[model samples]
Target: MYSSGPKLYHVHNCDTRQILEDYFSGNQEMVFEEDFLKFPIRNCVTTFKLGHIKGDILIDLSISSMIHHLYAACEFFKHIIVLKVNDRCILELKRWVDTRTGAFHWGHVTKLHAEIDEKSYEFQDKEGKVRSAMQHVVKCNLEKENMTEPIDLPPADCIISAWLLDVICKDKDDYIKYLRKFLKLLKPGGHLILVGSLEVTYFKIHKEKFHCFTYDEKFVREVLVGEGFKIDNCNVSRRTVESDLIDHKGVIFIAAHKE
Candidate 1:
């Protein structure tokens, strides 16, 4: 059997409360919040083994604060292509990926901007370039727009998303319609790995209460099968506490292959 190397991770029943309780006592890697140790899932993609280490990723879209997911993808995939639909996350991911003076994505690779829009809003620090370029992201995205298309780079081996499918199709019926647009971006036989939260992230900013929903793993499978993607694997990270550091706590992880 080929062993999962020390770099790869597989944490079953992975919960935050239990991990955090352990962390507060001493450890630093794990944390707790939604009130439990194991977290919950909406849907799950199968397990993905790094068959070939090619480092290109696409994140679909993200908010300014969700840049961490991009970093995590870089760390998890070994090689990644982070596709950002939002101006803020793209700016932050590019400005901070390297130079060793900014917020590093997941402690591994720092994504440098292959290209950035010159017309987007930009902010510099009154404190004289504080932390790093990513610190200026909030200022940059205020006027950001999706006026351009992502240039076609060399083929990528994997694609990833976090909590995106939940928003695509809430009732399962509309899921495929929303997802078909994204599937066209992937190269055939490439993989799509996703990790998403089960909680609403807007409680702190909006005047609305959020609803809890499952990602409908069955629907995810149906959509993938219909799209001609070969089944690879699927798994869920248990329900756990949400984090104020980022946003929600409950999460799910899934991996699939394109045929």
Candidate 2:
């Protein structure tokens, strides 16, 4: 069993399966289904359908092994490149991509995606499309100048980062620094879609609590604008679900294009 103390996410042993069980698995908790799954997926569908986020290459930098966030993306972009910070997350994601035995099932969220996008008839093919578009799941080291060193990547037309900055950043400055890293990866005027938790300090997987950086919507906007991003759309939703696993006040989604 894990301890009760709040553990730093990066330094601790973060079990990908435990994360799936505690957060993404709708059977265990319904709150994340709204905040993490539905909210981001809805925003993605809307943003991608706006006819401006178009691009050939899309990069994903997300917090967990979850791919529900990419269901809407596959239809819009031809190439999807996933960059993971840890080996575990890379392996976990590849398991799903390769359809390995005992891979975590994401069918429920795919159904949710179909329902939200009103494409229920094509539900059978959604997973395949996502799998086809996602060509590479590469490991990234945020500390390096070239996150995906040794294998130089082409500038992306768009990037979708879900709940990653909030988990990896230690403070407000760290957040800005990391945002700069993402900015460097995009081509000029490339779009960025950010999905994050607002006012959340920590979350628990099982018995071990993981640190989460707390920030408000205003800070996020200010940082983005200060870094030369033009906000195209912003959506924020207050949390209505009650759960002790996480203490987030709300969730925020922003679609911005770099100037």
Candidate 3:
């Protein structure tokens, strides 16, 4: 079993609704909007639309616990498997998928995606596509050799890990180890889409603080190459909205293929 540590965000007790409201909602700055929403959606849609990134099954390993980024993938992939750190996240996601009461609204994200694609009339269609494409929401233990346990999942054709390793890993070694573990979940030559917060060491969820592994663009490129991944494309977007809420300098997006 994975043991909890001090200075960690307890996933079990994390308030998904509050998280969505505080960071993801429109009231706050556009940091999350640009880094998480616009950039990922643009790249995913562009690549997939151009017949570059094609896949059957896509695995999401993002800690954000939102399906905003998956909207683009739904257009290309038939099935999507979302791996969460805890049952709470899984349940929260399922609530939205099932359209249950008190489910967090993702219409803003959907609309933004629609605007970017110039398909304003198809935003509802995009939402439905993501909802229907999601096939599983399984719990993940990053510290373990097998991240997804009690469920032998098939190898994925593409993996999307957004701000997950930096938050969960304690050090560089742990990050590398976790990266290797994540690689095992993908088929050979499969695509790996990563979104990381650059030069960040900490972030807060409500009152609790969590640690982030400090890294730069050079480190990310070197690490990915060293771990047998061929860099396909990488881009970094500098943070425009600064706040004491988070210490990130920028957000980095990388698209790679296993070598």
Candidate 4:
């Protein structure tokens, strides 16, 4: 393990490839493959099955170049707008969308999703659907009044943010603040699907530890109700895979809609 004495870098300073390979890649180098990949992808597939979650437009604010979480969503939403805080992430996502050389392979994730949904025969169509639905990969600044400024994105039918809030939020207050911003981007009665770890303090990329907000199920439920959201479904899976790369107690998936 790399020395932990150095200050941890925030998401903005992260290397796109490093983060992808270390946490989300389909290789021996990946440590959180079970927790990060299978957990969220399966959670999202089940969450999107609710009839109300689908719509004309969906905005995704997931961490890194996470295309797995959107596999189930692409079938429901006519258009998908991906917002990234950094240009590197935007480019990385585009590389996959365009099927460019050296782009990260997501076939493992696609297969997992297919097997779960009982559509194993339609493996080739999964990636294509995501590419067709995902039309925009725009830059966003959470601190700005309009996160996707100058673009004026239409209010989405649903917003799915996976593990993004945990990484970017500095504290509980920051978490609520960002929640409000996310709530504003949704249309009336639009669904918000959130997936992340419960009581996670930090996640590592190789040797570097990145800040992750620590909170429990109680806090999440209270905050969502307090922020004018009607909780629809909440599922918590105990951390079965033990690893030193991350210190998360359990994984939580919540599907709530703006009230």
Candidate 5:
């Protein structure tokens, strides 16, 4: 059965600082070391540096303060449109971008990316790049016909959706429908960088348990291929840490291009 709990991205349900310290900083016991430490930071940075994904417009369909992916995207894209699920997430992100007090610090993530890129002291540069590249923070509804409704955004050259579909989708068909909705925001031949929690049926945020759609790597690849995307790179990392925080076996990262 689907969860009737509070939405995961709701301000009260989600703690930006806690999430960064726990999951993104390699401190969460339920998150695998490689999954948090290397899979996202290293792979994304290296892929962007390879110059294979250069573009002018990029759309981010994940949480607002996803600095790990934004750091890489800033280097390649001139304009970034961050499509959020609600005002809470957008407000949190805006605080950071505006350098407001009490804004969640993402120095840990930026430092990690800098270290992996062998530019250990360039965290500030990465932050500036991301801040400069970011153009807008708008609300999006995955279940709606026009995901970014009331705001007709231009087609993007690339879309980065990380660990969002699994949490919001109720089933495999819903996941596929959302994937297609995301594709509609991208230009033909635009790239889709997708990150997912493998076999994760549910996760918790403090006291609330949020539902997630569980699926294997094969299913992910098949759905993307069936939607007219050509898989370019696919990486999976097994879980090494176990805790009551979340239920999952691994994480999957896929970089594909729409055909």
Candidate 6:
């Protein structure tokens, strides 16, 4: 495991899943013959249609988490729009896609991604083969400059506000208002995915400041439920790269449907 003193509020760098596996096993339910994380039903993902129904939009709001979430979405939907709320995460996610370069398996993700498009398997470059119909990934500045809160967004089919809400203060009533703005970006009967750690997250500014709202289960539930999102599945777990030797309870995933 890992050890840290109060001086080092966190015991890790970004790659903490390894050391964490030994320390924060905290109530993680393991119910499969093999590791259950690879199983779709075991992971609590919603099975729904994600392709265009003449008017469906997919928003990956958490710039960083969008990488994997988008990686998953790419198998089914095309013409997706992503919001670049956090440049750090967005850039990193883009880098991951560049590095992995069509490493996703359509056959593997098909059981899950195919609910959106029957041709989900066709989006792959797997088996050393690459398909040419490209998917778009870009940045949307919800708010920039001196503004503390973002502008309202139009509705869509699916929205994933990754790492976007991890900065609001517990007292910012604007937090709820901004969340509604995020929700309104989704059309009725659409889906949204909130991704981040549900616990405390720290960032080093000139000094150190607690992001306070970088990601949380309770905070997301309050905002989404208030904004009329129906909770589908709530998942809290970490991706363990044992080689990294760290664990993080920070990255939580919430998938909900708009009411």
Model 2 has an lDDT value of 0.87
Candidate 2 ranges beyond 4 A from true positions = 1-5, 28-30
Question: Per model, how many backbone clashes are there?
Answer: 32, 0, 0, 0, 0, 21
TM-score of 1: 0.51
State which candidate, 2 or 4, has the greater lDDT. Answer: 2
Instruction: Report the Cα RMSD per candidate.
Output: 14.4, 2.3, 2.5, 2.7, 2.6, 8.7
- Per-residue lDDT of candidate 6, residues 107-152 (tens digit): 4333333333344554444312212112334545444431223444
lDDT of 5: 0.78
Backbone clash pairs for candidate 2 read none
Error of 3 at 34 (Å): 2.3
**lDDT of each model, Cα atoms only?**
0.38, 0.87, 0.80, 0.85, 0.78, 0.45
Best by TM-score: 2
Give the residue spans of candidate 5 off by over 4 A: 1-18, 25-33
> Can you write out model 5's per-residue Cα lDDT over 7-112, one digit (the tens) per residue?
5443235665555555665444525446755677777876788788978899988743566777878888889999888677788788888889987767767777
TM-score of every model? 0.51, 0.95, 0.92, 0.94, 0.90, 0.53
Encode model 2's per-residue lDDT on 1-259: one tens digit a residue.
1256567665667886778877777686455788877888899888887788877999999887888888988888899999988889888889999999988899988899889999899899999999999979999889888999988888999999988898888789989988899878899989999999999999887766788889999999999999889999999999868888899999999999988
Candidate 4 residue lDDT tens string, 136-247: 9999988888888887989999998888899888789999999888878899888888988899988876677778889999999999899888999998888877777788
Candidate 4 colliding pairs: none
Cα RMSD for candidate 6? Answer: 8.7
lDDT (Cα, 0-100) at 168 in candidate 3 = 78
Clashing pairs in 3: none
> Which regions of candidate 6 are displaced past 4 Å?
1-55, 86-134, 144-154, 167-174, 203-210, 214-216, 238-251
Candidate 1 residue 81 Cα shift, in angstroms, is: 3.4
> Ten consecutive residues with minimal summed lDDT in candidate 4?
1-10
